[model samples]
Target: MIKPTPNPPELDDTTPYEFPGSKRFHEAAERALDHYLKPNALTLRFHKPSTMFQIAPDQDNESLLAHACESLASASIMTSDIAAYVDNPQRHTILAIQQIIMLAELAVNRVLDNVEMARSASHN
Candidate 1:
């Protein structure tokens, strides 16, 4: 029996064009946070090892957990590196980038948490 893989969440390709005199940067960040926190293709990539470790009923989920930790760490490092380049703090583009960085941070945190939970559950 061949089951189809589920599709990941779609990433937006269009640029965000904020009108109304360049206000609402925080609102935009809030919306971005809400959207980015959801699991997507990006997150699923991190999840595959977790799923495989479970399905194979391997010796342990340690490898998968390590992978998850690595993914989060990589994201954090990349976000921090990018943050060094921003000059104007008030630009919408800057806000959007910040939102994206925040989302990345959130994703990493969730991945780590899920990995820990999986390891803990497996011990029972």
Candidate 2:
């Protein structure tokens, strides 16, 4: 019968390794974290209370609708601009969002037009 050979150990104990530029790499990583990850003190101090849910009680519906239309139109334009530079995979999604914004703008404008017509008819 032939004798079988023994298998080697998983880890080698002979090599002593040292990474070059490790100190410089650590310093660069620390600087990047300090620059981008740390929160800004100025931003923390300038927090304003959100006005999203606070509608003025005295504002008229026509003015409010007009404002909504303007905001939607602006959003549509902004989305279109963003879509211009987006990759092909996400470009379609951004364009669809833009279309939705435009549709909302059109609806608001139609409501405003109807309100104006009703007011004019009442005055005549």
Candidate 3:
């Protein structure tokens, strides 16, 4: 059984773009693609922070931790207060949230104590 159209001629797969100085051009194209596509760690590290809220770079750790402890304590109190005003299931939820806040406050208090101890030890 003979076919109407014959088989197509075999040709070399290499294109004009693949020869001569194209190796350098290919490398440059790849680098350009990677630059746009890949997330660079250096860029991530130096990315701009939110302008609306930021802590002072010069702030000491002790003061920061102390503020954190106070904030967590206040949050715990607020959640307990809210729990008193809500329904049974909501109250349970609020109480659970309050417990989490209380645990955070305790952890912050421990860190504050450690910071104070370290400072005192360094002074002596």
Candidate 4:
């Protein structure tokens, strides 16, 4: 089941952040949308005060915590695959992988920024 999201006051009447590399950033976003967004039908479910930290009593926050842990584990596994350069081992491929990793980090930062904004707003 899905719940309705409350309108975020911080997001109200505010322009989205236009960081440098916005074009490439958008291209990557489009790629992501085409890949995961369409395939998984991920929706933007904003948090509300009542539901922000909501959990079952016995092991209240375990589900959310476990989700985060599992995400990290998945990333680590993927990183090992990306770090593998046994075949040609060309410098260019290594450099390209580095760039990909940098871009991935930037994407993670953007996501964290959004999360931080939500968290800060929730504290208000």
lDDT leader: 3
Residue pairs of candidate 2 with colliding backbone atoms: none
Indicate the residue-level lDDT of 14 in model 2: 48
Model 1, which residues run further than 4 Å from truth? Answer: 1-90
How many backbone clashes does every candidate have?
A: 0, 0, 0, 0
Question: What C-alpha lDDT does candidate 1 achieve relative to the native structure?
Answer: 0.65
Give one digit per residue, the lDDT tens place, for model 1 in 1-124.
6547546656767645456644577677878997878777777777745353354556455565556657655765665566567565635455566567567657766776787888799999
> Best candidate, TM-score-wise?
3
How large is the C-alpha RMSD of every model relative to the true structure? Answer: 22.0, 9.9, 14.0, 23.2
User: Which clashing pairs does model 3 show?
Assistant: none
- Candidate 2 lDDT tens digits, 1-124: 6547445535657432246677678878889998898867987689787989998999999989989998998899999999999998799999999999998898998999899999999999
Model 4 Cα lDDT, one tens digit per residue, 1-124:
5547654534556434467687678888899888875644334354334666665567634344445545655665565565674555664575565566556656665666676788799999
Model 4 clashing residue pairs (backbone): none
Name the regions of candidate 3 deviating beyond 4 angstroms.
1-49
TM-score of each: 0.31, 0.58, 0.60, 0.31
lDDT of 3 by residue, 3-116 (tens): 676577557697757677998898899999999998799998999878788899999988998899889989998998998899999999999999999999899899988988
CA-lDDT, candidates in order: 0.65, 0.87, 0.89, 0.60
Global fold similarity of model 1 (TM-score): 0.31
Per-residue lDDT value at 24 in model 3: 83
Judging by lDDT, tell me the better candidate of 2 and 3. 3
TM-score computed on alpha carbons, candidate 2:
0.58
